[model samples]
Target: MTEVPLIAPLWTVQDVSEYLRVPVQTLYSWRSSGTGPPARRVGKYLRYRPDDVLRWLESLDDGAA
Candidate 1:
């Protein structure tokens, strides 16, 4: 028998907002504008990959203009 980890690090819009210090409404706007981190839709809910978010942050810092 394998032990499963409880409480994954998956984040909702609110979580992302807290992490990024942005408003949840901005997250929604970014999601719709296709300017946010690539996300996986889990049952109609947006789920962001931590790696993707980090990468996005790095890219932005690198002047991805």
Candidate 2:
């Protein structure tokens, strides 16, 4: 039998901050500098895809090598 896959949940700024253990202000600064994970606008707020964040983090590891 085949099973259905589940969708990943979108993350909020606060959720990202907690996940990464970085301060919320730093995220804002990164956004201004275009150095943070890619996010999309939902109305007036920003939303992040977990996959994008994970890929971004992986890219950082790649740069360090």
Candidate 3:
């Protein structure tokens, strides 16, 4: 789905996990450990920027780095 917001696109944890094919728990772990993309808090919920997610993904090597 296309991002609707005008600002940096916000993504749900599930979205990022699914896009990256990683388990949701991994995302939670990264978030709790502050090792992942910066997340925004809104009414106690966490949201990640789509662009940041993409950038973080590009940083992954998968044995290619």
Candidate 4:
């Protein structure tokens, strides 16, 4: 039998803010400025992939060094 891996749920703006320890407004500002983790527009809401968020954080670390 083959095993399947579980998938993570898409994150909301509030979820990303809490995870990154930033204000929700900051995320909105970053989004507008095109300097934050990538997000998708789903209907009237923005959704983020957890993997993309982690990659963005890692990129920051890479740039800092």
Residues 1-65, model 2: lDDT tens digits: 99989999899999999998999999999999999999899999999999999888887855544
lDDT minimum window of 10 residues, candidate 3: 56-65
Instruction: Point to the candidate with the largest lDDT.
Output: 4
Return the TM-score for each candidate structure: 0.74, 0.82, 0.72, 0.84
Q: Which digits, one per residue and each the tens of the lDDT, describe model 4 over residues 1-65? A: 99989999999999999999999999999999999999999999999999999999888855544
* RMSD in order of candidates: 3.1, 3.1, 5.2, 2.6
lDDT tens digits, residues 1-65, model 3?
A: 89877685688888888888989899889889988777788888788889888888788776954
Count of clashing residue pairs in every prediction? 0, 0, 0, 0
Q: Model 2, residue 9: what's the lDDT?
A: 87
Candidate 2 stretches greater than 4 Å from native: 1-5, 62-65
Query: CA lDDT of each candidate?
Result: 0.82, 0.92, 0.82, 0.95
Alpha carbon deviation, residue 6, candidate 3 (Å): 3.8
Instruction: Kindly indicate the candidate among 2 and 3 with the higher TM-score.
Output: 2
Residue runs of model 4 more than 4 Å from their true location after superposition? 1-5, 62-65
> Order the candidates by TM-score, highest first — what do you get?
4, 2, 1, 3
* Ten residues in sequence with the least summed lDDT for candidate 4: 56-65
